[model samples]
Target: MDRTAPPLEVATATPGIAWPGLPGPAGTSLLGLLFQLDRTQWWPAERIEAAQRRQLAALLDHARAEVPFWRARLPGFPPPEDAAAFEAAWAALPILTRAEIQAADASEALLADRLPQGHGEYREIFTSGSTGRPIRGVRSQLWELVWSAFTLRDHLWHRRDLAGSLAVIRESGAGKAPYPDGDTQAGWGFSSAAIFATGPLFSLNVTTPPALQMEWLRRRDPDYLLSHPSILARLAAEVGAHPLPRLKQVVAISEALAEPQRKAIEAAFRVPVVDVYSTREAGYLALQCPDHAGLHVQSEGLRLEVLRDDGTPCAAGEVGRVVVTPLHNLAMPLIRYEIGDLAEAGAPCPCGRGLPVLNRVMGRRQNMLRLADGGRRWPLLSSGDIEKLVAAAPALRQYRIVQTGFDALTVMLAVARPLTDAERAAVIAWARGKFGEGFAVAVETMDELPKSAAGKVEDFICEVPEG
Candidate 1:
């Protein structure tokens, strides 16, 4: 429960150990920037904007000069650019969509020259495709440095115990263990280990059942828990009956989290739920504000725009599409890339941090349920909704709801035993009350619900035709 820094003995226990990729010049630069951000995050809004404008001008110059795609697109553009010229040209550029990025020639998008010194290594990142299609991206070591700095910023902002055991549950590769063993020196290869000693790290596949996951967490007794929103909700439901006494905090990432889910986790575990908004392609987008429930954009590394359907910027409390430009990613510049996500813009935080705020992340549009009247709305199901069916049928282990047609609904259930007629009737009745009797709901027993090709588990999917 102590959020203070680890004891001196723990910090000095592994003095020479370093994280796998953070040991050379790049690592030193990353560590330096992390320390810089620790101070810059407290600066005034105008100062932060000035720093962003400087980075923007440099990135635009690099893109126009060396990137083949941008060179052809921006014919008359010359290198010696200032913030004013950069802003004017950037606003005039068309928005880039996922399909275009996916179909475009990679060689054209990649910078053949002008890469930062000692930043030759690049890695390809892919989207989870929870929405409709998956897109690929390229990022260099310099880009990774920025990502590491932002990650450390998150750790510092939360004041987490550096020596506390960390537990993660997500999709894993084949033959991976439920609790992978750790090395003594690296202590589970945490980023903090590169600078200071860290506690052990344990992980298991999210595909594991709730009962087994509870057993796993109970054994580890971790101080911090990290996993996707859906898995965390399922684990919270299990913990509601039996608590994990050592659990101090929960970190939810990669999926949209509803207020009800947050409340359920907090009530069950009695710990704060810190949500991180990020994408696989763009790295860290926004982090949970320390003083508020909303997210503060990582303005130092990325430029974000929340715009309405007409492409104009959204004002305070307005919900619009999220487009991002990662300023530090020079391997492939994603200028005004539409990330196919929606978020509500928020007023500036009262916490004195100049970072922009996002009131809520509503997730991908394809996931919304379609009404019989041809209207789509996000099905705001609470923990109570899941508990209603689980209580009615004690044999139910897990469940998923999918809307296959305007009037057709399929309820997939993973159960220890087949549901009795009375229990099935109770589930049908609960669905009727929640989704209206107009929907023809059917119960289908299965071993488990299907996960996306990218390994994310979607609890709800709407397959109805959309205009």
Candidate 2:
């Protein structure tokens, strides 16, 4: 596929306007940023790092002067002016965690004493608490502008049709777009619609059953669909029966898109699946490359690091904990915040983009399995293995594995009916073979599996305490 960007075109709201392609003030600002990003994305790695250092210097200075929590931690007022000295000082800073952020938020220690002029009002935001620890922070209007720019950048990178209809199936609060009836808007919400005329956007809460969600999609027949990877997987099973003739692409968000889920969606829907790595607190962490499966970090807006257990940078193809610092967010600057996720670092992409690549996003730290020998590994269950298990137990609809001890696992099965004795033995045998031979595996049947508040269900969960 050609990695070149498409020609810039703006749609006019008024048909008879004298300036057909001219955009409004907001649109003009967005276009200005987008134009600059087009060149910055191709900058060399060294150049990108230099730019990030300059921005980080400014952010650190601001944090030390205005934020109380950072004042004590960031000693040596006014960071070093030399590049090498500054780099050393920056690395010496402690990695911030979710628990500390929550503590600081209670006392307003993380917030800036005063906002910069023209930054505009701030709004308080809370995370989904999927990690068992939700955090609160403030987002300035300036931060929102940067987020919107990145959102537009992702759309442009994929060369998506701006006028195509979009469907969103994610968490929805009360009075927002709910289930059954759902909701529809005249145009795609801000960032895209703020600049260009777009097709209507349809939304439905993800809590709706897969069968109903499929019926809703068949009714709307949208061009693009966006939802969590788990939701997409469940919906994939229904697509074989009720197809969406107009569906062009699927975007998986909120959760890591494993290889099995990706293959299932593409095979069932007969369309490409694009995965986006982002969070509620920090927006647009990494977006899938247009020409490759790897993801490119949004270095223009964030300073992301993949660090080893000893706090050193990971080499190419090394899996490490993800740490991020939103360079543009001044209201609540979370410098070097550990986001509780693991990802594999990659060498420079073949696509020629200077952005860093994440070879694969291995889910959260809690998702790894703990062995009796005090070792850890990501549980591997291939699609073929899953098919074999289903073949052995025809009543199995879905399954989730929960680690109860170092050598014990409980397989929760959502099935149509209780499995026969032979089928039960087969399920247990399969789990033991995949996990470990000496491990104890128990099978429990359930009418259906439970989903998170955000309507996401994980295939594995570790209940054992972390050492």
Candidate 3:
């Protein structure tokens, strides 16, 4: 494809209106950055389809040559190298099932063995065992560069003044420990040529005890704050909902941000609360646009596929698992990486970025609730939604809805204070209405709610279906 930069894109390519850091990334060079940006902006429709065909060929050829796991599965290569032929032979590639990924030998996935040699070698990361079995994978300095670009692009999308700002994701001082595993969603700001560009990434530990976490945020009155919604909600509840007028934007990531969570944090901080969908394994993926609508994928350097449980593509408006390919991760390129989440597909966005639009991202797979209607949906009947309906009511401190059986739900709750009859009725009404009246509701107020293995307050658990 002839990489051509249309005239309009020349200006739009650099999202920083004032061109913060005028020509960023010295390594990429001004010309090189522009060169790369223009190349990625949006491949012409026909060109993109063609490039996909080529990418498929490259992936198949590489897998056969370098990967034993795949070579043993694919019977033979195609002659014409067309999409139809590739599709017909896909099953031969052997499904890289989650079970296999969770237990695969890392040695089989790397390129030519022995680290792709370069700067400040670091230990390859193992998925902090978030889901019991630890997933081992490589992380490199080159990935750091790609991570920065994707993050900055998100900041630019927010129209934040980056020149004088800073991203608080890193430790303020050198030698400070990084957030363990996937907890690095704190303190991100645009780095343009302004006062906000202090570039002091710091850790605002969400899992820390509330007393200490309250003080941490009090001391680091960062203009731009980023964190998980659950942490932010807990903080707001702790601090008596104080105002931090300087906080222009607060971004929540890594977990579901319910309406109530957003309300509490926005009310407490007096800022626009934005949320992003990203992960440590794949870097930043998508972010909620300024319109507060669903997330828009950065289709430029990444390709995303929403697939059914059986590895087939999900039709539009259907929810399916998310698989992604990191186009820029040359060190250890991951094609069709199963990200372990579900999303609803929608039509092309009017945002006109060429990035695909995801109607809604269902929360973590395990968080989904099974319904009496012989169906299951997430964030659909979760405590996350119920929390919103009851957030403004100070009588409720905590709540949970566990599916005791196919047609039964137990609403275990904790009240910091006594609830009036109206409040009690409200809770019952919402529970039956939201969780389906077909299921019986039993409310049990307690002193505390049960915590998961990860020390998280699991408010909604479907005990009926064994996961």
Candidate 4:
């Protein structure tokens, strides 16, 4: 064994052994089993809602009883005080933005109230802060198992091997650890099927660097190759230029997987591109199902909602900000926590699961598009108007649309093969369609595009806040 290879000890947790016919990590928890039941298949929505209300009421009671922040702000509004009254005032409850959560010291944003003592065996998860910043938070060990349960449902829908397929993750950085002395196995157990994980940078410059790394990956011939979409696009182009080992699946996680990136990876890897829709499962509130209609919110473990600017529920199909109240994360509870993404909630999913569905999820708040007019900001591109234009030019595989001013903008492109005049014209024609022909457009081709800590390439970014 390579001296650096961490010892592989089969875990005795709920999910159990990761090999074929063996259970995944979810096998360790009793609550996990309860969540796996397909209740919505026959139960009424009203019943689910009622039960959920009771659960929320109980959680809030615990919060008031334990959490310092809630105890201070919610002196009179304790849980069970008036479940209906609290439900009515849900919108008025303190809305926690990323800035607020990240700024919070003393760990108030994370604690669950029911436990008699402090958090035990909890792991912290980090967010890329792709717009520019990233932060970390804790997740209880038990609830992490629940997250695994939810993922199994999504993966099973697609008919992929969750147990023993070779898995790959082009990591962003050394993510937060699940436990002291925690090695790669903890994450590997939750995500990949059997082996190999890497950084997004590894995919790029694979030509000059990782001379041995590339060979190892080829040897693995991983069934699932997961990484940021940007790096995948670059690697896809490289594979087309030369060839790597064929793969059964290519996945993008921790960042939005644009359609262009997906198509590019599929063309190169000769496989369907699946997205995990998360950095870690413990922090995952929503992820895509095999049906590919939209992502299903893990309502059993999380209560996800999308609210418009006024804090009202976003109407069906209308883009709104993503917020979550985690159901089982008792270590540090996230209630009415405004995650940075913009998404729309659809009606209950057709997957026969009682879980509500997210019709569309835009990029994070920082990636909000700056309108070419008076500089209005959009959460994420509600439409693929930009992606469609960039992909039209095959030479325009890597790109970014950044807002410099209300009407002024810069279009950055990392074009290895320069575009033909005709191709550029078509790209511009598409751009003209988006911002009108009179808009200023600057397209620069570079050797590489900037990336976030999570290894995501921001497709659309606006620095201006003057709406």
Q: lDDT of each structure? A: 0.77, 0.86, 0.58, 0.59
- Candidate 2 C-alpha lDDT tens digits along 78-178: 34446678777777889999989999999999999988886777878888877777788798888888888988888888877767889999988865776
Best by lDDT: 2
| Tens digit of per-residue lDDT, candidate 4, span 1-467 | 12433333333333554543333433434233534444542356655566667677766777778776667665445354455676676767878766666666345544554463533476767655565656677777666656656555544445544333344434423433211211233244443321212112112222222233344456545555666676677667656444455456666766777666677788877788776554342366666765557776666666777888788887768888888887776666667887777876788666566667777566676666566464445533323764576566776656777767666567777676877777666766665567656656666667667665554577778776744
Ten contiguous residues with the weakest lDDT in model 3:
2-11
Worst 10 residues of 4 by lDDT: 193-202
What would the per-residue lDDT of candidate 1 be over residues 24-54, giving only the tens digit for each residue?
4544676689768877888997788778877
**Which candidate number maximizes TM-score?**
2
Over 4 Å off in model 4, which ranges? Answer: 1-26, 30-35, 38-42, 75-86, 106-114, 117-119, 172-187, 190-217, 238-246, 267-270, 279-282, 371-394, 417-433
For 65-124, candidate 3 gives per-residue lDDT tens digits of: 655555555466564346677656643344454566545454445432323344224336
Clashing pairs in 1: none
Worst 10 residues of 1 by lDDT: 5-14
| RMSD each, Å | 4.2, 2.3, 7.0, 7.4
Off by over 4 Å in 2: 1-18, 77-81
TM-score: model 3 vs. ground truth = 0.73
Query: What TM-score does structure 2 among the candidates reach?
Result: 0.94
